[model samples]
Target: MRIEIPAKKRLVHETRVPIRWGDMDAYRHVNNTIYFRFMEQARIEWISLLQQSTHTEDAGMLMVNGFCNFYQQLSYPGELIVKTYVGAIGRTSMDVYNAMFLTSAPEVKVAEGGATMVWVDLITDVATPWPEAILAGLR
Candidate 1:
């Protein structure tokens, strides 16, 4: 049986990442753990963009959960285009979705994943409300 996941409604950010030799496993394909790294890069880029545009202070976010589903194997000596999308938003947390595609074959999805990030106070390490400017930018 197959399950159909709904398409992302909007893409908030995207960035290109080159695959390094160290990213591969003994099987010569990108290690599954590396896919999470790709997602993290995209998420950081998204936050950086927001920070630049809004000029907001670094009130940080923490990832509470993450998941990835691999559809195809990625080899070294290539680059990937990582795309990020925002999903549900709450008082202090939000869902982020990511999709990775080979730069050479944009239409082919190599892997996809998501993470839940909660707004937090950097010093206190406690949950905090999302700033107005950042929230506006996210929407």
Candidate 2:
């Protein structure tokens, strides 16, 4: 059976990153491993967006789980726009949806995925609930 995965245009925020020559593999395209770095960049932008608008004291949010699906090939020397958004906000975890697309070809979806991050106490290395202040910002 054929599965349908439609292109989504619900980017809450985006960051432009230039592809480096080192990102290419022997296949002459961006390496699959490099996608994770793109995801990391999007996640950092999402976190910073929250931090800047809110006054939360806790500055630590750790990724507990994440996965990605490579849809198409991305070559080096092209600009990649990493779009990110909060998919869901749970009691102690936040689900972030992210996608990487070519700046010149926005319709072409390069990759799409998500990450689940839990608010944690760095000193204790324990998860904690989403404070009301943070939740409000997420909404």
Candidate 3:
């Protein structure tokens, strides 16, 4: 099955992640789990930037859910361009997505995934509305 990302999702971050040899299985294609990891790396990178923009260590994002859809097989010895998108911003939560493609074939997406993330006050351990800086950063 295929899942479609938001047509109007904002592109928030982009990074390259090299495919490690050990990321593959006996079939020589990348394992399913690694795709989630790739998406995770993007999310963490973006969230870190968001936190920096907020200039606060007391607030952060929590990924309450995640998922991936693999449309093509990826092999080792290649690099992936991960594009992160964010949208559906709510009172305390937002939707995040990643579309990954081989560096050599940018037009062909190998996998895509997303997570529903919420903002939280780390010290109080409670959900909070997104900080203004974080909201500005998203836009």
Scored by lDDT, the top model is 3
Q: TM per model? A: 0.85, 0.80, 0.85
Residue-level lDDT tens digits of model 3 in 1-139: 6667779888989999999999999999999999999999888888787655432589877888888989899988999999999869998999999999999999998899999988889899888998777777777
Clashes of 3: 0
Cα lDDT tens digits for candidate 1, 19-100: 9999999999999999999999998888888864412366667898888989999999999999999888899998888989
* TM-score result, candidate 2: 0.80
| Winner on lDDT (1 vs 2) | 1
- lDDT per prediction? 0.85, 0.76, 0.88
Error of 1 at 91 (Å): 0.7
lDDT (Cα, 0-100) at 20 in candidate 3: 97
Tens digits of per-residue lDDT for model 2, 51-137: 643223554677887778888888878999898866656788877788788999988888887778888866667788877777776
lDDT of 1 at 26: 97
Query: After superposition, which runs of candidate 1 have C-alpha atoms over 4 Å from their true positions?
Result: 1-8, 52-59, 122-125
lDDT of 3 at 110: 87
